[model samples]
Target: MAAIYQVDSFTKLPFSGNPAGVYISDVEQDYETCIKIAREMNLSETAFPVRTTDDNHYRLRWFTPTTEVPMCGHATLATSWVHFTELGIDGDIYYETLSGQLKVSRIGDDLKMDFPSELPFRIDLDQSIGEALDCNGMAYYSTGTRKLLFEISDRKKLEGLHPDFSKMEKLSVGVPLRGLIVTCKGDGEFDFFSRYFAPWVGINEDPVTGSAHTVLGPFWSERLGKDKLRAYQASQRGGEIRLEILDGNRISIIGNAVTVIRGQMLV
Candidate 1:
């Protein structure tokens, strides 16, 4: 039997964050087995801790319902919670992942993570993106994700968007990554807020994506004048990250994780 741990990462509340399942094992598990478990769990993402390197560090991997991914932030937070809170695992933890080493620390009730920043580049977006979205936007950029980031005038127009998913899928054929539509001036405490949709990655929408903040935190932190600011992901079940931009290459994102479900499964 494998122990299954459900953790809500990047938020303080239970039903208002990105929920991930963490499975811990004493032995190394195959990729196919991990993918099968992820598909069965049917969450946006699942994490597997294959080994404990020391009291404070472990090796981890993340998988979506559709495929195994290189990196996952929210799941990393969730995994840290399972280690420190549930299983009595403690101290500063280091995760060796496909994207490299990730350092996580415990701060009172919240977990803080120092993640690498992915500074976005200005790229040319094709007309197909606009056509597929069925909206006329002024600017577009790509972050190597399937989604093209679209610039718009106001929140009203931004919120009124109803993308043609079928059209988007068809237009995605020469596209770098899925498409993301964002506009400034939304009605929120944070200077800006965003909604993420990546049907191309097999997730139609992510409740609260910590990875997206790699781009977002830097972009907003520069624009908003303060290194520390509040970020709200406007989803049906939303989440928050207290972000602090450090220098140019590093950023600190803070949030809390709650353990929702814990059980063991036959593998």
Candidate 2:
């Protein structure tokens, strides 16, 4: 049996943010077991944290319903929330992940995650992809994570996007990446607005993605000419993120999470 918690990350209210499964245990589960658990949970991502040599440090791994990923922001925030609120652990917590060492700390009511920034490089916008996204002539870029990022001029266009998931999946197959980020300039309270789609990774649309903002922070910083910005993910279940660009290609992502469900997974 394993303790499983369903947490809503990136929002203070429930059902408005990304929900992730967090599994906390002293023993590290096998790869197949983790995959199975993730499949059973069937969320966008599930996190497994196992204790390491240091009490404050742990090894973290993230999994989608279909595959494992190197990094995941919402799930990591959920993990930290579980540790802080459920397990009575506080202060800074370190995680060893495939993306390398990461840190999360509590600042007031929000948990601030120190993540490596990913600056995007310009790429030619493909016509087929534009057609699939229903927006053409959008600027396209790629990051080290291999996710495709594009920008639209109108926030309404970005919000009204109804991408063809099947077309997106076919186009992304065998491309070493599955996620696409579509962003636009914000209107009122937000500096920018965006959405994420990753049909190839078994997620059609992520409600609020923290990992995507690692690239967005730098990409928008250069365009908006600000080091700190507030972003909004315009999904059906909307969420917000506070971003701060740091030196050495690092970014601080700040958001709030709430544990919505707690149960024991009997396996």
Candidate 3:
């Protein structure tokens, strides 16, 4: 048996942020077994962290319901939350992942994750994407990751989107990206507002995606002329993220997480 925790990342409140399953094991499990467990959990993404030879370090992997991803931000946050709050591990922790070494630390009530910045390059908007989303945006861009970033002109339009998931999935077939991010200038307390859709990766809409912000932070920082920004993801279950573009092609994603479920995975 192994302990599994369901944590809501990027928000202090329960049921408001992205939920991820964190599976901490005493022994390393094979890739197929991890995939099977991820399928069983059926979350947007599940994280598995195995102990490493180095003290305070672990090899981490993330899996969507359908496929394994190279990196995941919310799941990583959930993993760190489980380690700090549940397992009683303290101080900074290092995660060795497919994307390389990632560092996470606790600060006050928030958990800060140091992730690589993936700035997007401007690209011509595909008509199929417009057809699938049924909206127009300021511009379209693609990051190194398998994701496209769409900058809309209006925040309300970005928030009012009703995408055809099947159409999106069909259109995204064979495309190198996982999903699309629609964003716009925010109002009031938020500097930007955005939403994420990745039907190809088994997630139709991610409530608060930290990894997507890795691209967003730099993109918006250049346009808005500010390195630090407050962003809001306008999903059904909305959440917030504090984004800062750091030096050396890195970014800091700051958010709070709450554990909503704790149990042992009997399987």
lDDT of each: 0.75, 0.90, 0.87
- Can you rank all candidates by lDDT, best first? 2, 3, 1
Candidate 2: TM-score? 0.96
Q: Tens digit of lDDT per residue, candidate 1, span 9-43?
A: 87777877999999988876788988899988898
TM-score to native of every candidate shown: 0.89, 0.96, 0.96
Evaluated with lDDT, which candidate comes out highest?
2
Instruction: Write model 2 residue lDDT over 22-119, tens digit each, in one string.
Output: 99788898889999999999899999999899978999999998888988999999999999899988779999999889999998889999999888
- By TM-score rank, best first, the candidates go 2, 3, 1
Better of 1 and 3 by TM-score: 3
Model 1 vs. true fold: TM: 0.89
Q: Candidate 2, overall lDDT?
A: 0.90
Better of 1 and 2 by TM-score: 2
Off by over 4 Å in 1: 136-147, 172-175, 178-188
Worst 10 residues of 3 by lDDT: 137-146
Q: Could you tell me how far off, in angstroms, the CA of residue 8 lies in candidate 1 after the best superposition?
A: 1.9
